[model samples]
Target: MAAVGNRLGDATSPYLLQHADNPVDWQPWDDRALALAREQNKPILLSIGYSACHWCHVMAHESFEDRDIARLMNERFINIKVDREERPDLDRIYQTAHQLLTRRPGGWPLTLVLTPEDQTPVFAGTYFPPRPRGGMPGFADILRQVDEAIREQPGAVAEQNAALRHALGKLSRAPDEGGASALGNGPLRTCRDALAASFDTVHGGFGAAPKFPHPGGIERLLRHYALTLTTDDEPDRDALHMACYSLRRMALGGLYDQVGGGFARYSVDEYWMIPHFEKMLYDNALLLGLYADAWHATGDGLYRRIVRETAAWTMAEMQHSRGGYFASLDADSEGEEGRYYLWTPDEIRGLLDDDEWALVEHRFALDEPANFEGRWHLHVQASFSESAKRLGRPRDQVVALWESARDKLYRAREQRVRPGRDDKVLTAWNGLMIAAMARAGRLLDEPTWVGSAEQALDFVTERLVDSEGRLHASWRGGRAAHQGCLEDYAFLLEGVLECLQSYWSDSRLRFAVGLADTLLARFQDEDSGGFWMTADDHEPLIQRPRPLADDSLPSGNAVALRALQRLGHLLGETRYLEAAERGLQAASGALARMPEAHASLLTALEEHLYPPEIVVIRGNMEATASWRARALKYYTPNRLVFTLPPAARPPGLLAERVAEEGAPVAWVCHGSTCRPPARTLDALDEVLDQSGGSS
Candidate 1:
């Protein structure tokens, strides 16, 4: 019943809508806001954050909501709010500016004061409170000082802005490392060595405290391990160990939501004991693949459990009725961070009988001091056998008791005020989850999970993609908006390819081909090789950002490279292959400088060094299913599999291939060279193994 207070009321982004009632007069990033700032000759206050970001909410409540601070912001600067998820291009550009200005990483809610003329940042910081605190200047004080400096010392401000522009421009340009010919395994070796050096021997993962699940890095490690295999015991075994160790610690620690399923955004502590607790679709998607690979490597029941549970959580919480998965789950619930997940000793006692409570207390380290602000975050510390030995009870009994306790606790937690969900269906993230679901379905033999992936893919293709075959970035409330970025097309292409392998469909294959064409037409950097983050027709920002570095998620260019390589080989399209090669060349310098940092790019580089084996299983669906299953039995990190009827089209790679025997047959090829058809599952296994798991 309350009236919305600002221009954010008309915005599509949920993050922008969250500020609809703020007295700050927030405008969504648009031409009107820029024009107003230019006309008024005032600095622009650009704040970028996502809907589910906790600090974003804190800043909104502390500074933007206060009328006094709002007045200061309104009079001096034209204020704009951006949902980082909605406009990753803008976020990437400004975050880079913030780093350039402050010599540190930028995070939400990113605050910047930019010139109205060119929108180059003059000042940048993150999360300034209403009152001076955390060694940061108060929002009002900072605003006043910035305004005074701009007015009193216009020449100095202009000089600083000019310097920033020059610096940013230099940073934006890709480095000239060598030529495209420099592409090889040299960078991959450098990266592997760096990871080995930084790897935490005592704990899992690399680096020090505040460990994040770098799924891309783990994936790279897995591939490196596969590539460098020399019997069971070797020095190269370290790669597999590092990846497995990190995943093990994470699964056992608070990062993995024990009561529910899925992973939090990251751990706040080194041991993965305390998490930030926001669940993101991208994180789970990446981790799912890693875990599935881990299971394939070790045949560990724990890894399998993780893969199943994470997929289950995604399906239950993230998937929308329309089929596309939601963006994220907020870290906060009921005005408190981790409130939905944390528990008290008394609360546990109330839910369980004395024996059950006691067992759980010891098993989850609840009897130890409270880990999260005087409340317990349930994290499994002891194995059932260990707890049973200590308690003088049978292991099975302990397991039964713990399961019962967990169910009751999960049920009770469900009744509490749940964290807010950002229901916007992101095309890139859905692509990620779709890939995860499809892979898990095939690898773990879960048809329902594969079906779930197909359904989500159907939703994205129908809703997010326009009739002209162009893809949109997001969808919500039966409407799609925002032109698709490089990631949207690239990631979805990967997903569509995965679905094709899971259950071959003619329409999805056509969709994949269309997406590949669009990626070339819209996002490709014609002169310089890698793809741009935005489309050629996209609204221009301060810079045309072409980010090649890997972050929490893989780089867009890296993903684009992999997608192109796979699709090219699958379809026998030389254009896609050439584009992929160009992409690798473009990223060559950056990869050479910091191969460890460019895990995904290193992966694409590996593919160039040793092209993936392409296996086309052509026959009746019923007969070919066994052959397809056998092809995936071994862990082939750099391999592409497609199971289609004898008559599937595009007439590219599958042109001459057909069913030979009464049973299904597989045509195995390395690059353009084809091998004789393998008629039996045993014959296919021998072919794959002879190539040392992958070509």
Candidate 2:
């Protein structure tokens, strides 16, 4: 085959590189591409999608690879390709533009036609076939029509540009009076009511089919339960129940890999039995922390098991050798979805002995009809307790048999062709995973996990972050490209903070402060009181989007707010606090209207309303370790723990506090007010009790 590459041959993003061989003259999202569009007076056809997106691959094959469609695109437009993961800021702007233009939710392989004059989007949509199908016009036809319209109806395009600008202005501006003085518990109540209304009683999770794991909402529920648990309120208990039930169902369902470990992108069914089967690093990372927290809250062994398995799976499969995590695993294997994961009853039977098959069949609902395209997506149909009782065997025996069967199955499945892995390391997603590993490792006493997190953080610092203390969005094949967005700083700052708790260092603390500074300088909307998705120096788009609503992942603005607040508390920086206040104020309106949708921001608000108690333990490493163990015994979300060694001279909150020469001394402090140092573990408990730390 002759080289048909245009500009994507040198791209770092695997998604863009995948289209390098396409006949279409694809260019990266850059100043050069935008300038070319303006110079040539051609419409900019921006196609945004990620590596793992199924429809993205379909469109690439059907249209981009087609010589006829490619010719039309190359001739009529300054074609640009974007990996959404690497440029979420661009994705957010265009996706919102698409929503405004079409009045429909925008998704992957987003096809947008923008005017060259202002780079204003005149038309937008998702995937379109090469030829007409399902009542939608063909990609080629759309391109031709858009080109003709741009040339012939310049006035109409100008009108759209003006209208879109107006809408964008309205959306970005802060409300008068900034928001309610105090949002209070009204928003919390609204969120609770909404979750209750949408809650699936039988199968768990919210809404209907094609369910996504709303980890942020689930965390809110858990926090809500913690807040009102002692009140003996029905709402509080119900919130906890819903969260627990949903988590339990997801863990047991096919969304969670039964044979292997880690979760799929989402389940395509309401029952959580059939997943789309793509494994993403971000999904598993968030779920790891969620399950770890659940275990801490309820002491559920199942949640513990899930945390262990998921973390293990992440390390085994998703993690890169050097340290950072990979982006995602594709949904298809050998051109068939779920081929790597699905198994038939006969296959299971052939793999297992008679006794093992009997237990496995009953446990996994093999007796029922196949639910996943004539194949069984293994889900726990019966609980272990029930299985033990039904099989007339001891619970321990049943567990042993199940473990044996799963090990054999996993080994056998490993021999099959695996799904394609998107090996690009994304800073934001890695930060999330790092936070998960750090927090879980600290709480669960898994040093290895903590080491993994540290290594990844180190990798990011050395490779992803450039000199002048700026972060890059993606790293692949020793090449780092694209300036970091708000998410990159916010999430990495979060990871640094979390990792600091597990194991502290002066360099890491400095790095955190640098990120916080960069966040404020680059992304903060100084006037509106919220952070913009893109930086001040980012490529000029139609609008600077400051989206607050939590999407598939938590909103970057929300994360920034929370991260800033946490940093403020840790470092005693009034600037961080002020910035966080502004962010909260900016978000107050959306939170007031539909708090359920702004779950991540609500979390930030919760921390703001009730400041976390700061516990600092100072002494020799051995003594402080003992004190740390005592403090971590109970599950306390509203507490920050720091075990400082004598050699360490901490700054900010712990700057004043010094190590007393003797056994470790624990000081339970809230802001500047601190009680006398507690010399013993018992004394520390007493101090904590008086300070309302135990509650």
Candidate 3:
């Protein structure tokens, strides 16, 4: 039999590298490992997790790092470790299989024992301890049980594997009957109603404890409110309140870094008082745009402050000097979760004067019981006005003192051991951030943020795309690896479109066109409808997922459909539009069944039902810039505003909308129809106000 040592030493993924020194003979999910497993007639032990996963780290220390456990793992099975971020394809397949077998939702550190020949999962679990605890089987016990099953009950194992394969196959196939003709507002309304029902009236956000930001759902609510605002319905107003309230609560909670600027993954409690602590690029990216839109909708200064601080934190800490954004920040620092972020009353008091300390104590609830392990993780327990009233100080004075105290605390926090950052630049995540930065920059009038987006776009185009124009999923330490997935193409296409709106670039337009073409050619499910998560030429896996529901990030299929619809309309390409409609048809059944779960797709469906309004401004560069800025003042979810210089030659439908005279002229098109060109800012405003409350 072929010998296997720890083969993850040469892996590009930081998550994989973290396990390189483990005693377990951990192999990266590769053909060689699979071949070895088959040859040895042993089941494949597949373990999947990402760098920021605290449980993944716990499993590694408790079991993978133990010599006796490693010995058992090496002797009984061919162990494969996958960084879920680096190989979401594998992660998705196994995670789904886990759910099917266990009848429970799957999570990180997913443990599965697969059939050697076909790689079908026969056993599934997650986060096994060193010894059995809390009714969970020990890692060693599970490993032995799996080995024994394969050896002594081969027929039963094979029977179960066959059933799982059939189940997975069923999941991959979309409903045959639903099509564009069946698509309607039922799902859209259902989604809004569901969100409203689950929304915590007092605390904000949806559901109970362990609250995720669910930015997609929040954005759905915002768009729904905008769409229905003209009807003057109380539910529409309530939708707006839900979105704004959730945004406010999250910004003020421990989920946000009180000392820093970025957000943690999610709040552990209903009140948003404690968080899981890992900071993800995708979460921030999605939330950035949400806050910007919220600011536009309500003109809330708090939303604007969140946008500024979060954007600053992203550029300062998460971005690579080469321009691409990094993947995530680990939940742990100094071997404990939330350690780097937590502090005592003494720490705050030492950093500020008596007045500042008093204000800080009340503002962040430092005087109250410790929220996390007897060390306070700052969350807004009282507003400035309330603190001002209680302390007999002016509100303005309280605010100023709080700011000073915050800066001091932040500076002091910087001196501590920081959480490890996963520095790999992922194309899909970078795409999300690019779109966020571009849109937020334009909305907030931050030119530097726009520049940052452009720089990141340039880096991805230069470093991640191959000679044949295919995108690499990830890049780090001068190497780009792994075939780009649907999200990589779809998200980047959306990003490119956003960048063009922020600052028109001819090369970027070409790039966007190429991405759209690639999606149609390489990723689209022509026979079924929605795009596959992997390209047609991707490495064969147990199953090819066509995901339409939003998870931590928005669904790739939904993003692809949205991007396609937008690009199709902008470029006047019927092919892209048709594909998007087909995708909506494919996802129609799923959307109807669980609309809230498919919030991202609900937005796409809304656009499909009511095509987005596209505004093209052409004239002298300086004059057109003013018109473009004016048009963007409102949060129009179903609008795309583009400005072009007189000398510029735009492609596709935009090519026909030429610059007239030396003055600015705006042409607004809804669906296939165009309104008369508006000559002045007043005329433009009148035209827009007539269009009113989004689509």
lDDT of each: 0.86, 0.87, 0.90
> Which is the winner by lDDT between candidate 1 and candidate 3?
3
lDDT of 2 by residue, 503-574 (tens): 878779889999999999999988878898889998777788887888988899888988888888777898
The TM-scores of all predictions, comma-separated, are: 0.96, 0.97, 0.98
Q: Which ten residues in a row have the lowest lDDT in candidate 1?
A: 1-10
Give Cα distance to truth, residue 352, candidate 2, Å.
Answer: 1.9
Q: Which candidate wins on lDDT? A: 3
Candidate 3 stretches greater than 4 Å from native: 178-181, 231-235, 693-695
Q: After superposition, how far is residue 485 of candidate 2 from its true place, in Å?
A: 0.8
Model 1 residue 615 lDDT score: 89
For residues 346-391, what per-residue lDDT tens digits would candidate 3 score against the true structure? 8778879999888888888777889899899989989888999989
Q: Least accurate stretch of 10 residues (summed lDDT) in model 3?
A: 228-237
Error of 3 at 673 (Å): 0.6
Cα deviation in Å at residue 691, candidate 3? 1.2
lDDT, candidate 3, equals: 0.90
Whose TM-score is higher: candidate 1's or candidate 2's? 2
The per-prediction CA RMSD against the true structure, in angstroms, equals 2.5, 2.1, 1.5
TM-score of 1: 0.96
Q: Candidate 1, after superposition: displacement of residue 4 in Å?
A: 13
